[model samples]
Target: MSERVMPGRADGLITLDAADALWVDLTADSAVPTASAAFTCSPAHARAGYVLLGSRVVATVKASGGQWSVLETEVRRAAAELNAVRMDRQDLVRIGPFRGAPKKERNETTLLRWRQRITRELQELGESERAVRREGGGPSHLAGIDWRRILVERTRDRTARTWWLPRAVVRLLDVAEHTETRWVQAARTCQENTAVPEPPSHPRQARDAGGRQTTSPKGPGASLRPYNGELEGQLYSVLSGKPGTSRRVAGWVCAVCRTAPATVLDHCHEHGYVRAPVCQSCNTLERPDHLYSNDIRVANHYARLFDTDTDDWLRHWHRCPGCRARTTLPLPHLAAWTAHIACRSLRPTHHAPRGRKPCGVLRVSWTGSQNAPRSCLLTVAVDFCPSGEHRVLARVPYREAVERFRIWLAETAPAVAAAAGPDRLDGLPAQFRPVIADTSGEGLALF
Candidate 1:
């Protein structure tokens, strides 16, 4: 209105100057070609002010700051309103322009829209049906989102708004450097809470290859190496405390086996005192709970199972009743053989050892043929007491003795035969399986 030409909306130049608060250079020709404006008359205008919006400037003055304060308050109100409008527009664009709802109300709506877009993209990729069933935060959902597409879209949208996603991640990582200290502290705390304590070992100082002394953890055996005299005195005291135990030399053989060298200072685990010095083999069995009272028996049992030199074992330990009675045959066969031997014993009719009369006499004999050496006739007879009545139990070939014995066993001692269970031959070595036509009656019959 003042006839000073204004800059056109399309092409104009705006500038600030020391003499003038505001100025505009116009591109379109006008009546007044040069334009300048001053917001205040004072060289240093502190209270007086102006509002510049693009090429327009609204100037104001006040008496002692009264009117200027009112104008300033109004300017602030207008500014807040403009900022709110901008933020609201940005919010609409962030979600959807057509949503016509606040960010809080539209958050789910926007999520649903993205979810649908992701689902469609995954379908285009020909993913399996399970992809849809996966949770929204799962790898399948992550794959469906297409991060490249998201980045591109975000960049495109930011370009439209004349802004950008700054290097915020780099800036955040810089801040995270301080947070890394917490991780170190957490690791130390975890070790303190979860570490386990171990038993302390004796310290041994020894020279390393460099000849410098180094201390290492030593075990019980290592701790005992330098105390042989003290150990011997203790062993002597322990032996003297026991009524029957005797102190023996280092090269002394085991008291039990009398074969292996005595090495360990055997002690009762319960009593915590040495009983004797014994070999490793004897010490295993000579515990306080089941002490080797019969060392011969222990030696004999072990000799049967593990010892190869039987002649020495027989000379020393076989005098034991258990050793003398031990047999290679199975228990069932042994019982049967015992019964057969008792049945074959013969004595006077109505025989009495000193007080009682005998029940009967049983006779078992074999008559072999000259032509067939392996073939023989088995004869079994029983004689009743006092009446002197003779009755034949079985008369069969020796090869058929097993069957005859089984029949006689069932008749004579039915309980024993019944206890033997089913007739199945066993204990015959694998090599004998070929020579034996049948093993129907376990080794009880073969014997």
Candidate 2:
């Protein structure tokens, strides 16, 4: 693809390829991280003149411009600088927080503390939300946001539950964004902006749990600062530069082959996600590609011989070209082996019992790709009594399946755990097979 440059600024250009791009205007006032830095995105969107945040992470730093240690030091330096900014004597005009009448009736110090923490949190978030500004009619630092104007905007947003995260995460990101704004604002701190001297960063006196300084800002305000790489690159990637195109998953599954899962992933052992998974031949270099085909053929050959009973004998099949070349290849189960193998999962793939409740969920990950005929990029989760019938509760993204399973373990397993706890169903993973396929999208396949 070719670049089409417009006039003046470092942003605002079209792709000759007419690609969907993120337009960032770096010529305006904003900080841009170096190209070598690795980054991820945050789910922050604008609606009703507000930024909507997603349930999970906004972005993550895949890498940085320098060595890991160097990045750490820069963060330290930034923290120390921001911490030094004296908040003394600046009339702290806190807003957006109010105690309900019930709280007033109860009059609790515990509630008082919670309210204070929230106030500080809002203060920090306000600082961050106002960090980036448009550069119209030439340039101006942060679009000259007057604190007074910001308070007005914030007040408008405070009618109800209006931030973009769960209370805990909102509080956390608020601290991060605030710290960043404080630092960036400090970088551009100059004369002629009306003399109210912005709160400058201080040299950190001591490092904390995050390797940040003790002298750094505290509470929600501290977190709101730009401490992580994800927050740091926001304005640059979203505002001033053209980020790369949508990353579609690679096409690993081949349609013509008619494999169970068209895509076969070369998943690295010990890795959480399926960055890759090796094919049979790739799995064992000495094992020729033909071996796979042979295995499939043998399985299919036996499947055709099945009498379906006492000869209730179960048989599998595979018609892979790689193994077809070698008749003596290892006997194999065909494309449906996964589902066939996991046939036991179908036992209680229905509703749970009344009242008492069901056990935890099951998590399955199909390490495959779209192009691979045998690719089953999927996961299955079952909820039920750990030692009893398995109940099919929900099928969700693999990531979520993991979380739900974890939560189930925490909540329902106590009784079963308390009694013969050590005999818990923890080691059952080895026996459990992934549900391969279902004509109804509800049935988990057992090979």
The lDDT leader among the candidates is: 1
Score residue 130 of candidate 2 by CA lDDT.
32
Top-TM-score candidate index? 2
Worst 10 residues of 1 by lDDT: 438-447
Off by over 4 Å in 1: 1-374, 379-396, 399-401, 408-447
Q: Distance (Å) between predicted and true CA of 7, model 2?
A: 55
Consecutive 10-residue window with the lowest summed lDDT within model 2: 438-447
lDDT tens readout by residue for model 2, 1-447: 114333321121122111111112121121211111111111111111111111111111111232111122222233233233322222222223433311223332111122233344444455445353211221111111111212222335555532211222222233333333333343344323535432222333332224433232222122221111221112111221233211110112112111111112221111111222122112222111122221111122122222122011110001211111111111122222222223234423335575433234332334442223243233333434465544433333333333333343335333322232223333223331222221111111100
The regions of model 2 sitting more than 4 angstroms off are 1-172, 179-188, 191-358, 377-379, 387-447
lDDT of 1 by residue, 164-258 (tens): 11122111111222122222233345446545422111132322223333222222121111112222213223454564333232335544455
Model 2 residue 307 lDDT score: 19
Candidate 2 residue-wise lDDT at 86: 29
